[model samples]
Target: MFLYTENFEGQKEMAMAGLSRALAEDRVDRDIIPLLEKINALDNYFTTSSCSGRISVMEMPHFGDKLNSVWLGKWHREVFIEEVFEAIGRHRSGQLWFLVRSPILHVAARTMDDAVKLLNLSIGLGFKYSSIKSVSHRKLLVEIRSTERMDVPLGEDGELWVSEEYIGRIVNLANAQVRRFKGKLKRLEDEIEVLEK
Candidate 1:
């Protein structure tokens, strides 16, 4: 049988440098900083990227055109229906969407065992979509995620496709999803210390 090996020391040096640059640039999300700190404090792991989850109303010229897309309103926490209405009013041209996204954290573990441990713990903490995202000699990455999500079209070209009542209903639904994912994030944050054991 053939065996595969990895240079964890080299990977750690690269990851540490990357993290330092990201921190110096203020690229890490503000809300997730505390959790990132806690995780980095552990010896066997580091973070590559993360988003603490969000609910947003976006205006775009077309689907997937991120270069021109504008966030009419965005909130990292739960949103109010009135806020959605305000965002909708700002749409001048193109499509409008109300979206709810689950929390996501990409963590790099020092070894396969460490990656698996983090993956299992995330899944157990209601991050049902968690998985080992990638594995190679350079890195073993675990992606912590949840199931909550929504992508609803509310209008296009400065018009409203749905009634205000319908918008309200969708807002409530998105809020529910936001609350659900936030709880998962909190649980993960609380339990992430287990990796140190």
Candidate 2:
């Protein structure tokens, strides 16, 4: 049985509840305890963060062959999102580098709406102007400068490469959202104080 919260606060509360429930349900299932512990710890990281970084991270395969469309399955998306959530729950700073299949950039940046929509999504996901970068161009490969944990590299034969750098950026992007949210909280606090006086 898995229960997640609607957001960070709920995550924290549910994690605590999960811990109690797990402890009672299986005194011998020690493994469940550790999982609950980890989830509980994530509360601090998640609560401190203001917005969610729902990244549209993608990658291309077979740039040298006939493959043109970026292939991302439903299960792949879920795992990616879960991995990102955990990564963000781990760190306080970093960039969210979206490793798309080298050609999504052309598709994403083809129109004004596309670029605007991307930026809007980034803002909604807690971007700090400087924390977003995209790596593309299969034929014109540029060396990526990152100390990430997850990297998915696609070869000429179309083998997806996953690395740490990609994973690390989730934390970075989430930290950015936290900072943005904190600012909003401060403003609200100040306004409330003024009204009280």
Candidate 3:
């Protein structure tokens, strides 16, 4: 058997410097900062990217055209039907979409073992889509993700495809998904220190 040794010194230094910049700029999301810090405090891990999750109404010229997507409203937590309606009222010349995304986190680990540990922890914590995203001499990345998502088409060209009552129904479902995933995120945050033990 071949022995594999990984040196994380260079990447760890870079990750710390980047974390410092993000902290100084207030670029990190407030709710997840404690988790980020906890992970970074471990010698074997660092976070490259993360989103606590969100629900939003957006207008775009076409599907998959995120470059031109305009956000009418976005919320990190569950939202009320009235709030989404207020956003829909702003829709003009584009496809209007109501989206719900689950929490996502990209973690860098010092070794394959480290990556696997985090990946399993995330899946156990309800991030069902957790996996090893990439592996190379320079990095081992574990992507922590969940299955809660929705991409419902609300309208196109400033017209509503569904009635206001229908919007209310979808909003309720989306909010429920939001609550579920936020709880998962919190559990992962609470349990991440287990990797260090």
Find the candidate with the highest lDDT and give its number. Answer: 3
Question: Per-residue alpha-carbon lDDT of model 2 for 50-101, expressed as tens digits?
Answer: 1111233332333232254332321112234565444333322222223321
State in Å the error of residue 128, model 1: 1.2
lDDT of 3 by residue, 22-47 (tens): 88998777787888888988988988
Task: Give RMSD to native, each candidate.
Answer: 2.5, 18.2, 1.9
Query: TM-scores for all candidates?
Result: 0.88, 0.21, 0.93
Candidate 3 is scored at a TM of 0.93
- Give per-residue CA lDDT, model 1, range 1-197, as digits (tens): 11122665666667678878988998766778788888877878887788988889999999889899999998888778888899999999999988888889888887788888999999888999999888776668889999998889888999999999998888888878878887777777788898888
TM-score of 1: 0.88
TM-score of 2: 0.21
Whole-model lDDT, model 2: 0.31
Name the lDDT of candidate 3. 0.87
